[model samples]
Target: MRAYLIAAVLLALAIPVRGQAYMTDSGRAEFDSRVPLHTFTGTSDVLVGRISLPDSTVDFYLDLETLDTGIGKRDKDMKKTLETDTYPFAEFFGKLVSPFDPAGGTQPAVVRGTFTIHGHSQALEVTGTLEPTDDGLRLQAAWELNLDDYEIKPPKLLVMKVDPVQQMRISALLLPESESGT
Candidate 1:
């Protein structure tokens, strides 16, 4: 009887008590860079992310090669400039720093984490909105980053140089584990 009780307690401990974790592999991430002569955008829909409702933890990552700016030549140049061969991915891993109710509708939250790019990592805090949905949650955030901070050289076209600072946007629809099909 004692052994059976112990087994039952262990099983209970192994089960997730809070809300389920959600994830998706087709999330979107994009950046817009504006120069005096031109403005362009690069986007990637291969972002992989996970959000654990139990712990309010968030993690996201994507391949550098997945970014497309609509121009093949420019995309190739970006890949080489970003040193995709050396640092193939950009990632963020952190926990929610603000109050979050997974079932309480949309709310603002701050996520504190390490943002890694171009082989460099920096501590960052991003503010975004979290909205609960039937399947899971939708997260959206916009932030700015300076190229020099990551040792990334700004690209130039002839005499026109891209801005050292660029605006970044992220939008992801997270599906619960059961709906993730994995």
Candidate 2:
């Protein structure tokens, strides 16, 4: 028993030895509506995300209520119709499958991961350009997510509202951790 306890402690201490936390609170996620009739856009604050550089894995979360389309009524309608209160957050977790030489500067990379929204998680791949700036890292990519994947029914209030598909754009700035406890 003593040996088992020692091993558990050692494993816990070892996990953080090479792990780092890079958080970006101001990361912006925008969704655009380019249907033939109306065009809309909104912004949201990314709650928290961390990258395990040693393992090339990343997981992030966003507050769903942060969505804004520049119009008040539309926003209210969306919340009410979509039941934002029940599904307040969305999350994405995936690994950076491509080789990333952050110290070498800017380059293009593709990240494959899973995205969870409205309680449903699905596999997704996003290709984007990455630039390691003096302050942190900048990643820009856009992808289309089918609302049905997450069971987000098309808002049908008053008829002729909402789009069949959602186009999302993400621009995130992730700062590197100063040191890894590991």
Output the number of the TM-score-best candidate: 1
Tens digit of per-residue lDDT, candidate 1, span 19-118: 3788889999999988787899999999999988778789999998999999999899889989999999999999988998866989997999999999
- In model 2, the clashing pairs are 16-182, 17-182
Candidate 1, residue 7: the lDDT equals 97
lDDT for each residue of candidate 2 in 23-111, tens digit (9 for 90 to 100): 57777898887545778887776555666666778777788788887888978877775677887777889987888886877777777
Give the 10-residue window scoring lowest on summed lDDT in candidate 2.
173-182
RMSD of each: 1.8, 4.3
Each candidate structure's TM-score, on Cα atoms with residue i matched to residue i, is: 0.92, 0.81
Q: Rate the local accuracy (lDDT) of all candidates.
A: 0.89, 0.75
Instruction: Give model 1's TM-score versus the native structure.
Output: 0.92
lDDT leader:
1
Error of 1 at 84 (Å): 0.6
Model 1 steric clash total: 0
Q: Clashes in model 1: which pairs? A: none
